[model samples]
Target chain A: MADKVLMKGNEAIAEAAILAGCRHYFGYPITPQTEIAAYMAKRMPKIGGTFLQAESEVAAINMVYGVAGAGYRVITSSSSPGISLKSEGLSYMAGSDLPAVVVNVQGGGPGLGGIQPSQSDYFQATKGGGHGDYKMIVLAPASVQEMADLTIEGFDLADKYRMTTMILADGTMGQMMEPVELKADAVKTYEKPWAVTGTKMARKHNIINSLSLVPEELEQLNFARYERYKQIEETEARWEEFMMEDAEYCIVAFGIAARVSKNAIVAARAKGIKVGLIRPITLWPFPKKVLCDAADKCKAFISVELSMGQMIEDVELATRCKKPVVLCNRAGGMIPTPEQVLAKIEEVAGGIN
Target chain B: MEPKRVSLFAGHYGSGKTNIAVNYAFLLKKMGKEVTVADLDIVNPYFRTKDSEKELSEAGIPLISSAFANSNVDLPALPQELYSLVERQDRYAVLDIGGDDRGALALGRYVPFILEENNYEMFFVVNFYRPLTTTAEEAMEVMHEIEDACKMRFTAIINNSNIGNDTTARDVLATFEETEKLSRLSGLPVRMTTVTAQVAEDMKDVENILPMVLQEKYFDINI
Candidate 1:
């Protein structure tokens, strides 16, 4: 039986990580995400796990690097500004081919803008939150329950590909409460054959560092990561298509915004709008193939976000700009109400009709 | 930002409700409580608690809300945070519910789950000097709004009615009386009564007060 228990997004991730055998967590305090750190801080000690509150996000990410290098499942999370701080560590992890889980519970931002929900970080996450010729397998969770499920998947995928996985969430999904079935056996123990625990006799001396002085070596590492990414694209790209059958227009959104968008699609359909929703569950792989198929069927696409036209760019790219992609958004600690999204759908379908 | 606790602060609109929540969370951090405030204000954008993220974070009180949930950034989703807290045990969480019945309705969405998992006390902060302060009947109306909306009883009433610095013990008592009467009518309890320092020390007439302390984020609810 799937036990139903209401949980915040932050707590869901911790519980999921515990299920996925993530035994180490390093994080710093930042808005919209401190619950994750706080949760781990309390529970890790009881489970004989380590939860380190690093001095800053930068330090936290590096701490993740050290722990993950030891071949243990480790995770670090933060909001927009803090994610930016951890980018360097992310690049290092990607370069070293280490498995780690990173979650971005995004808030509104260009700078330290506001701690409101916004999807402006779409480009930042999919394009790479850090400076690198690399990609993190990013999963977009629209509900709190998914937050738990995906965090578990993130660890599994990371280990499978020797990759870093990120759960890209918006503030609403992070803060909202919904029933979830927590994974069992709060204590997670994993066997890391590659961990560098002082080169014990059980394994060879391992140097798990993200450094390659030669240009060709770095290029080879980048290509290897890309090949893994290609596999992810072929297999792990996921999305939910609602009422797309015989629909003239499709709305593309992710995270909590997508849930609200799905509700709007339902409302619009009730009003004879013939609108559909294409929710990209995996943001990094982008679900381009499904979207391409969706584009062939729909007249136009609407990119709904809490920020100005970030994910819309991807929609345009995915569809090869064959369809007109219109944008409707709100920013700076604001949520685009369901009515607002329905209004945009009405307008778009009016033009199509 | 701060420690995590399961708390909800509720009141009518324009009652300095958000301000009180923000300042109260700030004070809790100052007293060494690890607190995280959720701005579950889906109704209003103006006074949402997340507006003070920078300041609150600087004060060591991390704030999480609906706004921070996204796939691109690294904010902790509120559901994940809460569940982890329950799994881990002994963390403080505060939720700043909206101003009206709608806000309470929003809170109801999570009440059955969080309350069952972790025993939480919901506080209804009241200002006795406000428009509804004159009568116990009026006070019950607000409580009913919350009860109907949230589908849960307000565990306790935190009598916070005061007239700035001029507030007196008599005024506090009147508000407490009304809250008490409403509690009796509604079957909830007046868990604690808050009073200004000047009045707190002066009122030795009734000595066996359950337990009331300065209004701050990290105070012991058990005490």
Candidate 2:
């Protein structure tokens, strides 16, 4: 059954996390997603959950680290600049193999970019968000429902893999309202055996930290983490495909860009353009093999995004330059319209008159 | 190599052509289709095809753009490898040309001979309300300019007119009519027309008959 509740992406994330057994949440107030913090502030105390509006994004993520260290489900959410401050903490969490979720309701920026929905951070979030040989299981949500669903999934995957996960959302996804059905309450709780807590009965006090003073020890830890990453890549990659049966051209996009891209695809088809859409649900553990197969058949590829040209580099690497991938995009708070997308499609696949 | 179906996307700034090209490639990849996209636009500094590379690559779709050759810089020249792909293709290739007429001229240098030899379909994307092209005649004129510069016959038209989120099915239909008129007068077929999916869903009156599959080659189009 679907509940017709109109909730923004941020509020839905908070609620979803709570339902997913995330009792600890630490975050700072940031524009475009302040509603999430406010919602958590009101709900966490009543539900006996820990909600703390930390002094800074750095503090917020560190608080998440502390809670996750205690063998509990936890999370932190922030916008672009705030996310930048939390990068150090994110690296630390990844290094220590802490299971937690980080939600970034992306705003425009390199510095304090405007509080608008922008996929500019696509690279920052999909690639190593922090400096180190680490990866965050990046999930991109195109709608509010996905924001909620992916947040819960993020937590589950993080715990399952002992890795940090990030829900990479833009302002459009964070602020938009859509109908969603709440998952059954029975789906939330899980137990972890490899958790670090105080020494009890017959155990040693586990030290959960990223500090590796010895070079050899650090190298070995990094190798171990890479092995885990390899396993994750082998199993956790996910994506969505629409109307791709015998498609000549395909559009590759994620998050909100993907939703708009679908509209273009449907339109292109009506006009006799055989196009489809390949949407990546997970940014990391990228569906590389899936795309490679597409490359083997489809005539052309297009990468729709909201940045200058960051993701294009990766697309070139993935396809090995076998085909030409076109870029269609917008920036500075402007969302790409379906008509615009159609024009680009016409440019690539065929002409539209 | 079996020649790949190649289309060159050209429209006004902020018209969303890049978005369409990118998404088209993604959909093809999802359908287990092979695709390659080229970001040939060097004019726009803020928005380009390079933004979605990471997302696309993660999906196993390949991107053929100049962004890889020069990092922290604007693309000034088309890479040789990209030219070869355009000339003879074994994969689906879409060239995302820049916004202005100057951009089309820039593409002229790289694609004129190929366009003539391949008899590729060149779609002059028009947003009716766009500054110089509110009327069908104006669109025809723009088409002429592109055809002359590219040294190829302008074969078809794509009606991509819209008013952002406010676009409706009626608006799309009206624009499609105007585009059809232009195509008829120009002796070029209307290759395709685009309407917002939201509008298509809401109106329930517009009938879309064409299959959304990439099976028809250049000669198979009804237009």
Candidate 3:
């Protein structure tokens, strides 16, 4: 077992990306997420990796596209507003089927909100921030350890699916510190037959681009991407259920909200409320089946989020609105306290009888 | 001997000085001393002594921070109450200085008063794993820079070399020779070494072991 040392979430993600064989990192400095770029800038050179501070988030993601196209592991990170700027580049990567890791150390939304921690980018991350029928596999990490673990997993899943994978972290998760046991440096064996590395008189030259001018061909490409998405939804849906045995009410959350909801569930259970929590690790896959199963046994549901009920829509769709789904949220960089979430749980559990 | 009236912690970024300061404050409180932590870290907003306001308050230790702390605003507005605590000689106070010479400038503001009234020990925390201060000479240079910025001399050094989650006992001991060299170069004593609680238990025979509670962030609720 590796020794445990305390590290902030942003630095942990950077270290994990390096340990996952990521050699190229391109990112612009943004509040709540700048530590990642700073860490990479210092460690990347020492480890013989490339760290480029691009002029803008747009240039950073496009640089990631260029690196990923050449068959090397690459990454880029930014906060919410910077992520908005990277959308066009994200769309190009998705269209080209380039495998890369993009980390969203999410802050408050819409416009330049604030530098405080926020999880308001749920829809933007899971629904493809860029304009297209493309999807990026979104992994929501609740702890600093997961910030490291899921980053490595994000890289693996991106290469496995030939798509972009995002570590959807908010300000709190990105800034907090925890003990993380990083994985050992593993050998890379994954094949990248579609990489646009120089041909060198090889069998054929490969081209990487997202522009398909032919209408029928574009339609066919969209269909194939959707098919892969369907497979991911079936096989890659990841979630964790806590104290769900004979739970009469369920609290659904992800990321930092899920961490707070766990405390709320414990408090509620101490008072014999019979409430449990369902934490979605992969937001895009949505973990609909587990939610539906809990919906059958639970009398009510409370979707705890750091936004204005963004994930609740998925909770509702997952359960088909079979049971009442209430929302307990604080948006625009405000975090809901455990007491606040417990109050909502008590309210829902009170009406259950 | 009586405990030092004031203990100040200064270090580079990622040196884990904030964690050491928090743990030491609790240690003083547990000894039945009136303890107060002044959060002079106006540079980095992410992790600082101010983030543990609730914990400190719960432990009956008052935390004095900047006015706009833990917010998006980067104002270096120090609370007036800190001046009173620094003036008081009855209580033990821990001043958590921020990273780099820029952060040490916050401590420079109280230099005249600190030098006049209080008997304080400023600890220069050294973490070899950090990029800038990787060697004895580099660490000594940073100490001199911090002293010049804060207008105060460091009385002791704390060896806190550890990689996050990848730190080992060997990693901590690897810096002992260099830290000793640093102590000799700066004419300061090697005060103590910080390690995680788990590591501290196994290496109890090691002298001057400061067992640090891993308080990296505010949120502790993990499911």
Residue-level lDDT tens digits of model 1 in B103-143: 67767667766767656667776665543333566667777
Instruction: Return the candidate ranking by TM-score, descending.
Output: 3, 1, 2
- Write the residue-wise lDDT of candidate 1 on A109-195 in tens digits: 899877767777888888987887889888998877789988988887788778789899877777655556665543344566677
In terms of DockQ, the best-performing candidate is 3
Worst 10 residues of 2 chain A by lDDT: A1-10
Candidate 3 lDDT at B174 equals 76
Give the clash count for each candidate: 63, 59, 1
Candidate 3 lDDT tens digits, A289-332: 99999888999899998888899999999999999999999988
Quality class of the docking in candidate 3, CAPRI style: acceptable
Model 2 per-residue lDDT at A71: 88
lDDT of 2 by residue, B136-181 (tens): 8877776777666555565566666664444556656667677777
Residue B90 lDDT in model 3?
89
Name the top TM-score candidate: 3
Error of 3 at A313 (Å): 0.3
When 1 and 2 are scored with TM-score, the better candidate is 1
TM-score between candidate 2 and the true structure = 0.61
For each candidate, give the interface RMSD after superposing the true interface residues on Cα.
Answer: 17.7, 14.9, 4.3
User: What is the alpha-carbon lDDT for the whole of candidate 2?
Assistant: 0.73
All candidates: TM-score of chain A? 0.95, 0.96, 0.98
lDDT of 2 by residue, A1-353 (tens): 01233355787899889888888889998766776786787679979998898888988999988889888999899988888999999999998889999988877777776766688887888787689888989999887778888888988898888888999898777755544555745355557665777678678668888999999999999999889989988899999988888788888888888888888888899999889988889888787877888888788888988776566666667777777888988876556777888899999976422
